[model samples]
Target: MDKNLLGNNVIAQIGILVHDIEKTSQVYAEFFGMMKPEWSLTDAVDKAKTEYKSEPTEARAKLAFFDMGSLQLELIEPDEHPSTWREHLNEHGEGPHHIAFFIKGMEEKVKLLELNGMALTQKGEYTGGRYAYMDTFKELKVMVELLENDN
Candidate 1:
């Protein structure tokens, strides 16, 4: 327990990033009878194929957020382009990718992670959330994301 970092009051938002988002989401839908949460759907269609190039992308994703009473289940699928989903699938096949911890000292924590030798792939803000992606998997492997709700 990181206490002030990932405060104990925060809820768990479990994530599963599959190459085929729909197929994986279906599994949860069957088991828990979970449907997509309306307000949590976010798809990034502008992210580049490899890097954050200026070029447009068909790289899309459908994330279904399922309310599991205490903890929530987030199911993700990449649109076959530049993404953690694509990269993860290329190496490890389909599986649960990252566990996002809700933190308070995001900038400070990022600096600490870098100092400790964790590979930071990208560090930036999205909407109102401040996030840092670090490579914790084998190659350009799984990204351990620290998301701080700046709002």
Candidate 2:
């Protein structure tokens, strides 16, 4: 098998889609014995800075992150917008949606994925970082999200 596109030995954050962030987060916190996570809305994502399938979009979602030692568990409550989160929930129901890896050389990585026939399904900017989701489910059985933190 060819090497993984996301690189080997890099920890990835597990992302899940939920119908209600508060309820799901509460359950996760209780199960993990961690403090309640602070959820953040994706409303601040400028529509002009987002795209879906290479087209402009106004997708949004509610996100909460819980640090679990070296990795994070991300809970996503998607709005009625046209985002990958919403699409995943609609297609797969409440469950794991994607695996995200923080990366450098984002443009190059994106290009490489594109060359390999993976299309970018979603992309947006939030705070100090930008993220792109590649539709790799057909081959990898899961979407791949690349996060670039400029901090």
Candidate 3:
């Protein structure tokens, strides 16, 4: 069993995936008084088209991160057609996309998810950071991310 998944992990962040960033930024800034600082715009984005042929149109997402206290609030916007965010938006129109939790023993947790039943959707390295994806779709409908420690 994956004892590494102990719940000391805080709700480190919440991500919102959208279609327009500049507009949404204003909305959030006004509502939450969220400060948009320099060096907050993330240039690291990797995209791949979904394999669902039955799904309508082709879409992709661009990611940007914002700091809220010690945690980050990542905003993602689709670049074209109708991607995951678009599908979510079309079905429900822009809301909380995912909840990121910080945890210890990332690699062990990922391995345990694999052992239990979760499927790994993607894995990659970006901007000198290491990350992995585990699908929790059928039940949770969220991707569980295993992020390498910054230290």
Best-fitting candidate, scored by lDDT:
2
How many clashes show up in model 1? 0
Candidate 2, lDDT over the whole model: 0.84
lDDT of 2 by residue, 65-110 (tens): 9998888999999888777888889999999888889888788888
Candidate 1 positional error at 28, Å: 1.0
Error of 1 at 122 (Å): 3.2
- By TM-score rank, best first, the candidates go 2, 1, 3
Best to worst by lDDT, what's the order? 2, 1, 3
Off by over 4 Å in 1: 1-11, 36-60, 138-142
Residue pairs in candidate 3 whose N, alpha carbon or C atoms collide under 3 angstroms: 89-93
**Per-candidate total of colliding backbone pairs:** 0, 0, 1
What is the C-alpha local distance difference test score of candidate 1?
Answer: 0.60
The candidate maximizing TM-score is 2
TM-score of each: 0.70, 0.92, 0.65
